[model samples]
Target chain A: MKISCVTTFLMCGNFDNTLAHNLFYVNMETPTQFISRIISNDRISEGFFELSLSWDPRAPVPMPGQFMTVRVGSLAVPLLRRPFAFAGFDADSSSAAIIYQKRGAGTELLAAARPGDELDVIGPLGTPFVIDTDQSKHVIIAGGIGLGPMLFLSSALKSRNIPARFIFGCRNKSLVPDTKMFTDADPQICTDDGSAGFRGTVADYINTNVSLDNSTTIYACGPSPMLTSVNKIAQSSGARCQVSLEAVMACGVGACMGCAVPVVGGGYARVCKEGPVFDGGEVLWERM
Target chain B: MGANVDLSVRIGNGTLANPVGVASGTFGYGGEYEGLVDFSDIGAIYTKAVTLEPRGGNAPPRLVETPSGILNSIGLANVGVEKFISDKLPYLRTLPCAVVVNVAGASEDEYRRVVERLESGCLDSVDTNGSGIFGYEVNVSCPNVHHGGLAFGTDPAQVERLTSSLRELTKRPLIIKLTPNVTDIAVVAKAAEAGGADAVSLINTLVGMVIDVKTRKPVLGAKTGGLSGPAVRPVGVALTCKARRAVSIPIIGMGGISCADDALQYILAGASAVQIGTANFVNPKTAGLVSSGIREYCIGNGISSLKEICGVAVD
Candidate 1:
């Protein structure tokens, strides 16, 4: 009933897809918050770091495209939790990892973290990526720091015995994550400077080289302009596209009403709750 | 277990089971933290401010983390009065904690109308026997909205009239949330009490600005937002004490209260109760921790009731 009003108010008398609404908003399972010990903290590349933590056995294992918020400090400054998408998850070991860039104060604090350090984490949060069983092919795209969830999605597709084309974009070879970290799902690297596997942007290569059709599904996580371009490409080829978003988040829960992004419709949706992953068609590219 | 220590606080006709509460805006309508935070330990839940109509809120980048706080310009985004009764109120009714409806509006009549609807419409469904809507926290202090937020709070006369008008509407506690952005918050507190307000909560966020160097643009879509968390704790404590000095009504204090020790600063300075604000985003268990910690402090110090410490730290 609460969700109905929230959904009704957010719906601008223009929604035609209840399936998408249910998949993204309704029937949400509550998230769990717990203290997890850091298993490993490593700088896997220049400007990129990966911190792995033990997952709470009682909570549901975070699926591909889902994110978590880590309490960087116990005090007031750096007051809000830092949100990170799950880059990798090992079910048997009951562990999860986030590949982050050491850019701000939050990640800087996170970089100093060591093995066995207790970290407060809330997770298996937001809407997870929905994989279709009948799609003939999948295309996974990740850009720099956005590699976190895309990396997880690539592995998810592989486990289901699905074939996919993986492309990861970076400014240069140094900014790219180590190939060893992505052993589970091999990705074709595309650097702006042509210092890696393929030259030019990920969208550039896909527009020129990759063939898309109704049978193909495109999954992406990247900067806004790149996503806008990818969505255009997918739309032109009649391929369904899902783009994972990144935003400065405060509660990471639905409460704060921060981390809002405009959808294709008139109203705004909480990226922390309604999604980090939104269908490309539902996105307002011009607004971004 | 310090069960003998009386943690409850009386505000007008309503009584808070304990003194620790999650501030409005930070706790949503109490549904967001259901599974995450233990609600049984919470004394009250001040829900997100409800306006006359649904608000879309500010655009993206509504929040930013500062040194020890968060700057937010959520623009009082909410589900409105109708949805509040139909959607939010039911879930809040089920919570063990006291529910305080935080009301905000663009005009005086809007505020009155919302209060009127809530009091009249919720007569039958409210679990007053249990812990239902015990009171209304008037949010004239919200800095994010353009009209009827800071505009109404900054003026003492406006606050007084607003308080009295709403005061005449219901028998429940009426807490006027004071904004620290004002030059003299005590003046407003005195007005609220003079207008027959049951209690007043202080202090709302201080106006702050953050600029991005690269883009040469403001971090928030709204040029400025309200600052909460530890950054404003000292300001909140100081203003809260000033209001305490001027008014006899119970004062509910909040700023960057992350734990009980911080809450004690307000309590000692004269606050009867305290609300956990930005810290809720950091740790949802802060209410439980703060309430328990306050209990221990009371027991250790041989303090039987909150009256023993409140107003001890005089100006």
Candidate 2:
């Protein structure tokens, strides 16, 4: 009788690491694809998830700033799925849209996803920007796609009746999405080219318009360079700022540790574990 | 009737449910995956290494991906012992299996401080399923961010001293995690045994590096970090074999173990148990598959238990 058991074996009669406790894990094979219906794909803002989608409710809800590795091709050239930040989820519509730029291999595939084409959604993974209410009023600052997390956070704030403002900066007005989503706070937009909204950088706009009272807190996500600039602005302004950092993440979970940001103290922190969102004061901006 | 396999294996004063377990750092305080993974299914869940004071960890650029592996300089970022006990330990008590605390001390006194706190029986409380801590792993192999982690693990006397000092604290079984960056891994393994360690885990992480050719600077915050993943499995198995021959104590093997075939190699080479570290990144389900694979191998081979095959291939 052939019998095999996943049992601990003795090595030369010596025992291995002592058993500590019983651990239970779910075998949810994160499937690479899903069946869903697209309700609407509206270009809400320069970068927004205002589009409605109805898909497998069984599909996990996308976390804020959490990404999806979507398959973009019917061919083998772009074999791997491109990762994009999940903008938001509409339970009523049952659909989600990811905001992204036309970058390399997988991202180009994302831009090609037509209506009715089923998507292979892989995630909702990665440590999300943790919003703490006790800290202060939420001030969301975005540079380009950095605006993705703010939309969802704004909806959350609106539902909670929390005071929040959206500061979005892009290369120019053409790159900035429409203003319907920002109807809440009269979003302050800045384009480097002075093509639309406020002329100059977002940090410049924050310096000109926003005042840093003791109750002010900032949440920012965009280019690392922009985050660095925001980090300095928030520091000088003396506002508690949390920035959503983007790194090349392989396994978005804490495992890969590929997405690590420098901590201000002395050691390194796993962006996926310690935080995708970290207090600006705690990060070593100069080094990054 | 085929050979009766006995999965029950005894080392020091304790017995583990199986040989497959989680390594330190990779599996945070155990509860991080509690909702997703059954803490009891694994033979042991090694908590993050706790040092004397709370660690803030290294600056960014801490992790970089290599060909098939990863290099991380996380600088052992962890909430100090106080928060660990207050926040994380309560969850450990609720686990149905044993909780192995990985201890890392900047100084000898700090190690004692951590153990002293746990000795009060607070950590051994009844779990949600009513169970207590299974054991403690002295993670001496963790690379130091201050002086570099390889210094201590490479020195035999340091290994012995670190182990012996902690051995006097509790009667609980102790396993020393060993670094593979040294010239000879067996030397340190023997030193651990001499220091009264109940067991030793081999191949913590090979000191490695990856540099982006586009930029002159190296990847990873520290420039070099511990390499782990499927790329290192062969080396891990070989080291386990060498450590097994050099010492009489039990050996916990880990490195690039991703599948059942890889784990069996470690068992055949004399590792009593194995820890799945880097693979946890590829798939959270890898551990379960490995566990299931182990059982399947035993069943198909007509082996009744895991113990029957332990070190069966040793020459």
Q: Write the per-residue lDDT of candidate 1 for residues B44-127, one digit (tens) a residue.
A: 999999998999898777988788878899999899999999999988888888889999999999999999999998765433
Q: For model 2, how does the per-residue alpha-carbon lDDT over B202-301 read when each residue is reduced to its tens digit?
A: 7888878888788987776678778887778889988888887899888888988878888888888988888888766555556777877888888789
Residue pairs in collision within model 1: A76-B68, A77-B67, A77-B68, B229-B256
Residues forming the 10-long window of minimal summed lDDT in candidate 2 chain A: A1-10
Backbone clashes under 3 angstroms, per model: 4, 58
Residue B65 CA displacement from its true place in model 2, Å: 1.5
Candidate 2 per-residue C-alpha lDDT over A79-175 given as tens digits, one digit per residue, 9 for 90 to 100: 3234566566666666676556665655555555556666645555444454455656778888887776677666655555667888888898778
**Error at B168, model 1, angstroms:** 1.9
Alpha-carbon shift of residue B181 in model 1 (angstroms): 1.2
